[model samples]
Target chain A: MRSSLLRAAHAPTELGMKIAFVTPRYGEEVMGGAEGAARSLAEHLVADLGHEVEIYTTCAIDHLTWADVLSPGVSQLHGVTVRRFTSAAGRDPKFSDLDARIRVAPSSRSIEDSVAWVAANGPVSESLVEALGDCDADVVAFYPYLFYMSVHGITRVRQPAVLHPAAHDEPSLYLPIFQRVFDSADAICFHTEAERSLVEPVLHTAATDQIVLGLGTGQASGSGRDGAAILGIAGRPYLVSVGRVDEQKGSTMLYEYFVEYKKRHPGPLALALVGPVSRPLPEHPDVVAAGIVNEADKWDIVAGAEVAISPSAMESFSLVVLEAWVARRAVMVNAVCGPTMEHIKASGGGLSFEGYLSFEVTLERLLGDAALREHMGEQGARYVASRYDWPVLIRRYEAFLESVVARGRRSEVKR
Target chain B: MGVDGFDLDQVRREIAAEVLARRTSGSVDAVEERRLQRLFEQYSPHAGGVGALSDALRSVDATIFIDPDVPVASSQPAGAAIKKTVRKANYWYMRWVTTQVTKALSNIAGVLHQVGSELDRINRRLDLVSNDTPAVIQLADADAWWHNRASEAVARAKGRVLVAACGDGSFVATLTALGHDAYGTDPRAEVVPTHGDSLDLRREGVIEHLDAVADAMLAGVVLTGVTEAMLPAQRTWLLRALDRVLAADGIVVLHLLKPEFLSGEARPVALELAGVEPLRPSTWVSVLHDRGFGVNLVDGGPDALIIASRGPRAN
Candidate 1:
């Protein structure tokens, strides 16, 4: 009883070095790349570096609907303390109206409209913002800047704000309200330098301390044999596209382009679209939509394909491209997607397409030369091995976090 | 290989040339870039003149007249015939009414434009009277006899130290070289990092810098340049700012010119414009004592370095 009373009086010392993450939605099953990246980072920081980790998130399971599926309260998930808050709103119709106006002319919108739009967008949990005020962690990290959790949590907390802005070149990034979000961050974390280059000048935060940390890719798995069989197709030359097969991911365009390519070539070349199909796919004899394959199967399909393609024009970081490289496969990317284009340009393991013509030309070249495909795949695999090995990434992350904590935002005193 | 070492630029160039060579038609659509507006900043009138708003107003004034001869055609054949007949019959009256309306509108626009010009003139004259900006000074001595002593005391201090009016940020550099977390604020923009520097230096006046800082945040503050020509009112404001922002255990290092030297012939031309010179070390001692600080003085040729510690500092 005496020991329990003592523990109650001095609680912080019991929980070693404390750190908290404020992500919009978090779970191993969560499909959003940024959310999953945050979860992976939190788990690794706890298991590898021995930092006490806490995840503050909403009860929403699906991002688009933001439906509160899980019960709100504290629980343990994968050895980390998880606090789930109920969202104040679900789907706000006004958000669409405001978003449409901002989309037409994003940079000129008033800061008031930007604030209203951010609040209008769902997953607004008042309890989460309140809890951030009471938190006594060494640092609070708010991931993926578009959500309401980051917009409110970073300003409410007294500790240093580390913003993991999984940002892309989108209209919402130009909103005036994001200036405050960028300025409030004691240190900004970016997934790619390309993302940094796009966001840094929005609020003149070039002098702000920052780190570019890409998510770690898993080890190579599965052989290239049963991938074609799993798709219910006979062995033939096929190109695979990974990630959410939705209109936003450029799936519709890929479909149209692939059909046209097959029409011109007049062969048994096929296209296999992978990952969760958010939108319905049109039926075609040459096209296969195998949605949400397991990790091993995903790698198997990547290994089996002639060229792994990411057709999306908007991406902050393309982890799928790196994964394909790990599986020793050549990839194709959209030229305008800054993050994926950065990856392809850096790796020399992929080709980029502007439109149908370039796509046709690059595809024909890669398909015609097997030796060229092998060389590109090997080059990409080597690049991934040298740059994104897990152990080195973790060490660099841990060291950077320690330095930030030690530095104490003392420079902010001169502001 | 590191991705940085990859020769992708050469390949990208090759692809660009190839795509351009194969362009047989203008079928490839032009990608329209989205229009963007810069962040809004409020316009303030200065001594120079008015901004783009005045130009826009002039443009509107020049185009306010009604064109009266707008075509009377309609898309429908029957409607077009009827509208044309009516417009011909009423053309004389329409021209007379439009001429009067245009005259009134044009006159209003011209008057509005004239009022804007008058306001611009008044604002420029007001600016001349209100602006009493300070000149940047390079008077702080980086190699004073007490440089090591001041740096040692600050290096052993507990929290962050600020060097106010740190010309060229030399004192800040000295403190940082000794591993003390130090930053400086100078009135001169050239003294900041853009002038071949890498230190933490902000371009702001001493009081402007302290106003942004949270209360009780600094463990130490080293002051220079700003002390020599401050008015009595500014000195009081400075003391209040210092008392608020400095921690209870904080120390202050002031590099001031000797009263005798300030009164000498070699004193700066800038100081001659000031109505009041700086206080002596003894006067600062009495003034700082009332604010609960203990003061000590160190001699450096023609200057006095006042080291004031709040109550009793641990270091």
Candidate 2:
């Protein structure tokens, strides 16, 4: 990577500095994408760069419930200090009602209504904020812009605030209260260019510095096998989709399309839904509802498939597509998904489908040609290694954080 | 190997065009699910006809382990104590039973794996059956033809140069003698030279060595012997790794075996073990060209000697 993002980060700079990440949830078991990403980044900061890192989060596991289930206290998770505070303001009963009002036209909502909506969104941990206010870390990263930990807690930190804002194109993003969230941030980190485009417009006054510092992929491992013992689709060709199987994630759409495709194509191509099943899946003979498989099995299923499909269009950055590419599996993505569409086009690793007709055509094309699939998968893998490897990301982040620290120092001098 | 010069964008365009053509042909969604699924099953990466045999073996190997430990406690107070006492009393019996079960299970699992040696011999013979082309046996040459050319090509290489498949480290010594910090890796144990340790000659294949190497660490590479031995997938991985590890100005000197060397020759055991043929030198040149490299085919004779340098796409 001659003109690499990491090239600037690799240049002479600070060696090690204390970094803190404040997220709403924290742990491997906590499957929220943003929280998991935060954990990986924090761990990499420690392991790869030898930086002192800590995580300040509410003891909340369930995103929807916002209940403080995990024991509240300082603990070591994956070699990083994770300080969990009991959720002060849990999800309010009136939160859904208030959220509904703000959901329709968030920009037009009253400041008071927006603030209430945020608080009602809950996971309001006052103790975590109080701790952050006195913390000695160089900078605190408040993850995923929608959360109270980021919106409210970012203001409480003594050090420079870096907001990761795992921001997606959603109604909650336009809330009047978020103008301050972006304004108060020292530096902003975005997941993808598409995400940056969506959120930057909402920033009336942007942060001092910002970067599309995306998430890294797990270096591909394991040989994918026939789904005989794992998914019971032994010797059967399968199309695997990894991630939560839900309506919002577009699994329903994917299922309908596959069922239609199988009818049209007249073949025994099974569809494997590999994730935590939230909604009821159909009892079709071909659909293998593998629930939530382990990471090894997930890779195994994905690698073994004729094609891997990322059905969701709601992604900020589809890490699954990168993962599939790493495993050398060709991918099919939702055409409307800006970030995933961008990835497919840029990498030429996969195809995107607008609907059933497009899906039918793309799936057939991928299934028929082994050489094309292999080429595309290799290209995707190359894209991921060049752009989103942890080493590359951590270096860019190190440089970004260093600048944030420098800016903070400058601001203090001005004061 | 067959699908040379395959372009994804071109393929996508063709697919789109076909889809459009099919749509124009008024093809309706009247296909059968059961039949389509069966056809799909055959196309699965897992079940590629005889390749399914490999999958079955992998499956057997993966599932062979029989974990012996099981929970041996009781919920009731007396029940737990009684169980513990009985467990202690029958410890020898329990150990014997577990041991026997484990042994039995292992023996069953080893039923396939035990024939590994026989399978190797069978596989070597099968390679000849599958591919009847003659192989040209190239013995290790201390004064190899490409040594001087490689030595000169990487003269100004910024960092250490790697001489892969350096049989007896002669080429590596030649480069080191020429003042280039050259190291080598060869898997053959008998080829261990007296100064192998000092020369940084690791006992592993180049691909294995490159897999663990830090990105953009190598200044130059000299590949020999093992290039033809690589499987198609391994070849792709080697290219990717070289792209990642080789510096911008890095030169790669490839001493590829002649493609005319086929399976019929009284070949080395390693050649039979490799179970593959050499890719055409032109194919390598074209691949390197496609990947944005300044390729120079120094000698496309008895054994093709190509020198390639990173081009503008060295990212």
Provide per-model DockQ scores: 0.04, 0.04
Q: List ranges where model 1 is wrong by over 4 Å.
A: A1-16, A223-225, A409-415, B1-14, B25-315
Q: Kindly list the interface RMSD, in angstroms, of each predicted candidate in the order they appear.
A: 12.4, 18.2
The top-ranked prediction according to TM-score is: 1
Instruction: Write one digit per residue (lDDT tens) for candidate 1, span B42-123.
Output: 0111101112446446345444556556576678868877878888888898899999988998888878878888988998
- Global CA lDDT computed for model 1: 0.73
Candidate 1 chain B worst ten-residue window by lDDT: B32-41
Model 2 interface CAPRI class:
incorrect
Q: Candidate 1 — which pairs collide?
A: none
- Over A74-156, each residue of candidate 2 has an lDDT whose tens digit, in order, gives 99976798999998778898887886676555777777888888889888887887888777777788887888878777777
lDDT of residue B246 for candidate 2: 83
